[model samples]
Target chain A: MLEGTMTSTTEITHLTFDVLVDLLRKIFVRHGVSETTAAILADNCARAERDGSFSHGIFRVPGYISTLKSGWVDGKAQPVIEDDGAALIRVDARNGFTLAASALARPTLLERAREQGVGVLAIRNSHHFSALWPDVEPFADEGLVALSFVNSMAVVVPPGGKKAIFGTNPVAFAAPRAGQPPYVFDQSSSAIANGDVQIAAREGHSLREGAGVDRDGNPTTDPRAVLDGGALLPFGGYKGASIALMVEILAAALTGGNFSREVDWSQHPGAQTPCTGQLFIVIDPARGGNGHFAERVAEICDLTREAGQERLPSDRRFRTRAETARTGIPIKAKDMALLQELVSE
Target chain B: MLEGTMTSTTEITHLTFDVLVDLLRKIFVRHGVSETTAAILADNCARAERDGSFSHGIFRVPGYISTLKSGWVDGKAQPVIEDDGAALIRVDARNGFTLAASALARPTLLERAREQGVGVLAIRNSHHFSALWPDVEPFADEGLVALSFVNSMAVVVPPGGKKAIFGTNPVAFAAPRAGQPPYVFDQSSSAIANGDVQIAAREGHSLREGAGVDRDGNPTTDPRAVLDGGALLPFGGYKGASIALMVEILAAALTGGNFSREVDWSQHPGAQTPCTGQLFIVIDPARGGNGHFAERVAEICDLTREAGQERLPSDRRFRTRAETARTGIPIKAKDMALLQELVSE
Candidate 1:
């Protein structure tokens, strides 16, 4: 709650998604990318906004292009599948974009599930994924329960032994229903995700309270302190820390990818220790005699909604997508200016 | 932490587990349970203590036996497989002891996983099991990844809502490895499990600081008030509540069991409710590339161990299990006296 930076007359505006995405694709193409990569990047940028993850949308494109041009990411490198068979697959991103690798892995897992009734894929040496829900939606749409987890560079300290030792690992879960929004819960174990802090910094805002500690391990309210050596606090302290640890093991540890201490130290720039490791699991219901697992899932959804919670986990995003498709994208004036400048290349 | 009566003692010894179980079994047998049911009851009582979960161990038997005699629990009843098949299972616990039913479900899940590579079981209308780790360990030992969750009477309140709307849902996760104990982490989303509060109360000690709140939402150090109308604060506030909600859906909602406002309002003597639900999932490594999965998992374990944290997630449980096996069971002074009394009966 304390993390948003204040804005006065910077003048935020709402632009249609297509208009904005086209603008982004143009900029990415100008920055030296193949059409394929540019489209994915555009989708990554647009999808986040459409999904209400504006912080990871076009606001990040300037920085992304800078990194791409500086060789922190390859616009043309192809991700290599390290291993494949049965119900599992592993992919190496070859220092290429993670969205590319993540986008690449989701379908692979789904395909495996189609054949084997379950699927798992891990990715290492990849770029950062904007939001986990996007990567998992495709699977859920195919009538599967999907779970996703990713470990970031260390920003939060471990439980007792001090000093930062793990990242604000994020977890995304979705269960499909026949005629309703899936029960969706996506969360980061940290009090506030790292991207929130980065966004605050970009907007010149302050950090949320209890979100992080100063370099001294003493709690602080400053956003900059969190972005620096100051450690981010776990969501519910120990329980949150435990979840982060679980995600770290599953995403980084089990995936043969980088853990907290081993991750890239690249907050500002440089050849980062390939931001690595993620897990995608898809479970099919028809095998269990649950006669249309999705139908039962719909029943459960009705109960939750009746309890006064929202009906659809992804309803807001889905609505936004439908609206954006019909109307347009929402882009702020400053972001629009930046997009134009970056594309003038 | 101040949610229960409290007393303090110097230190407990290995006699604690066996002594407590002996008393609990006698109490259950005296309350009209068959000898086998008594043993199962005793096993749960002792397992909780052996695993350092004294809160659920013998400390609970007296009240549980009283509840059973009052017909709050079906002492002579058995779990019936209301539904079953390939990848899924649904058990009608028939109001039988949750421990016994869960114990019964473990092997079934493992057997199914052995054949299908993945298995799931949902149980409803059951009593509370002492702990979940004991439930999932067998599957882990069988070279499968296992996870189980249970929803109890409301303990954790949802965010932005004053009413208690979710349980301090407990989750247990276990995975197999080459040698050593299976990696396991059993946890409650609350700051301190409600059961832990009861233990502190009996020990005549004050609850730990910052553990819970009294009814007015004001911080308090009174155990009775904290447990009475006051609610248990989740481990990480909103994040903890979020997880409680997640489990509420997955374990209770999915199981078609009572949840949230639906649980029987009585955990004490002379009280009963139809409130209960649990879910168990097991994945076999053999079909999912078990060999490579194990190797990758081993590497991850190595990374955690090498980090030199006092103990990785499962270290304490592993150490305790080893010590128990070598030196017999652990017991406390008061518990031993209680056990002696029960044995005499």
Candidate 2:
């Protein structure tokens, strides 16, 4: 499957889910990860690809490998869960990938929520490289409302500041329906995600107004400026900034982890994983005694859908998931070759 | 305090907290509320005024009086709290003001959170006619992170629709610091709160771009259009819309209360309070063993305040609170007259 020379602007080829996951597994295992850990991480990548999150899929594999190679992430370390309280589960990630810790923590968290109406899971010392929706969607599938917050490396500037203060902290919420797919939404507090800005720079696309600012705090629509010393502004101005601060406190401060400002990237060079944090809160709606929870959710979906050309949140993602499931996921030819090369190395 | 005529831009007169609370207590008493319940509601009004939330202060007293007169809100009713689970307190508000119910449920809620690391209070069959911050700030004062969501009358439209399908649902969050006042924020999901739009319409002021749309779904900056046969748009487009939907589910549906769509305004012709719902979640930072939570919060505050010309979320509110406490709450003469008239009636 020799696709042409690796170029930034290359045509894409379809890859089966099995084949893509297999390649990711091989690449992770080649970097000295346990086969089980590699499989878990690879599953996360496959889900990202299946959901059309190309940036978080194969695009992030190299970064994960780099972190592992630099000894910034433990490939074989197991997560330890502590019952901090009746409704709280604190997960020590043991300096490994967050996916492993989250995988180990979710079932217990859900069980606690089911028994106690609400449960909170705080993960510390983990490297979260995957999209947040996957972490919360499973709880929603079990008929619970789930919210997830994660603080990453600081790349987003505060509302009026020139320097980066908060990470592109993301908040995700998911709620289940009776028969339909759950209502799920995952969004970064930044005006635009760094991954999207990088994609625009690579594709020669101009950003919309207010996407980011130059180094001197002046507004700019140039994606390259946002990537080079410039910082992405929060969405909706100060409102987004406030939410980011909340995430930083809840994920980093409350979880006994490093804040975005505390993550020193220079100490470990390229792809060095930061000691990050994640918080997941799951609530059982049944405890509220609202017997028709599913019907109520469906009604909301109907009202939102009937309100003009608007689509329900995560509708597009579910559609893409269906499409990718039928037709194979399309990967850039260059990315396909890079994955193979990483495994071979 | 007879300072001005009842004009659109009437000057206001200062009313001492004692006088204002006394007036509110008398009005509620005249309307047949129990003295304790009246005192609770009066305290809520005073806090709203002290915090400079005039829309939720005396400005809403007439509505409360009207609802009581219309026999929609049972002013003498008491809230009942049920321990649905280890971490959940379900409050049946008994068709009364939510403030009373919240006051009744708060102690248990705080205790539950302290014991279990998290607690949820779901309030049902209540008229939550005031600001959301008051519901969460008390928790924050007790060294807990708090979040509250409430759904009200349908006045805001969905993202693409011309008609209002959702209320200007509000979400509030607060976290405590050692020396500083708790970091607090209460924001409506709409581009602007309905009261602000009403004030702008009365003052003949144009709204900011993307505030709302006219009857035909054309974007308009005219506040009158938004108030008359038009609908307010959600902030940040679909992201705000999604949050509004979450509030609807969590507040109304999950609490076995009425959604904005389910509220039949025609049935309750004038000032009859619809049974609204509120949900509050509190988390104890001690659960995660994060001892420096206050310092971490302060660091975030410094970063945001130092970044630019931006004020911290509740800084202005705290200042207003201090000013109100010192110089007394300023109330429009006409509103003062109305309150007196209601009490006399």
Q: Please provide, for model 1 over B196-300, each residue's C-alpha lDDT reduced to its tens digit, 9 standing for 90 to 100.
A: 777666555567666676777666566776777876666775556656766766676566666755765455456432358788877665553336555555655
Q: Specify the highest-TM-score model's number.
A: 2
| TM (chain A) per model | 0.87, 0.94
| Tens digit per residue, CA lDDT, model 2, A1-345 | 533222223587777777778888989999989888899999889889878887688778878888887777789989999885479889899888888988888778888898889999999998888888888888888889999999998788887788888888999998888789998988898888877887799899989998898878889999998888888898877778888889998898788777887787565656645678999989998885767888888888788778763788788889999997777787877887898799899
* lDDT of each residue in B109-219, candidate 2, tens digit only: 888898889999899888887778888888888889999999987777887787688888998999987789999989998889887887788789999999999878889
DockQ of each: 0.22, 0.66
Instruction: Report how far residue B3 has shifted in candidate 1, in Å.
Output: 37
Model 2 spans with C-alpha error above 4 angstroms: A1-13, B1-13, B272-274
Candidate 1: lDDT over CA atoms?
0.68
TM-score for all predictions? 0.82, 0.95
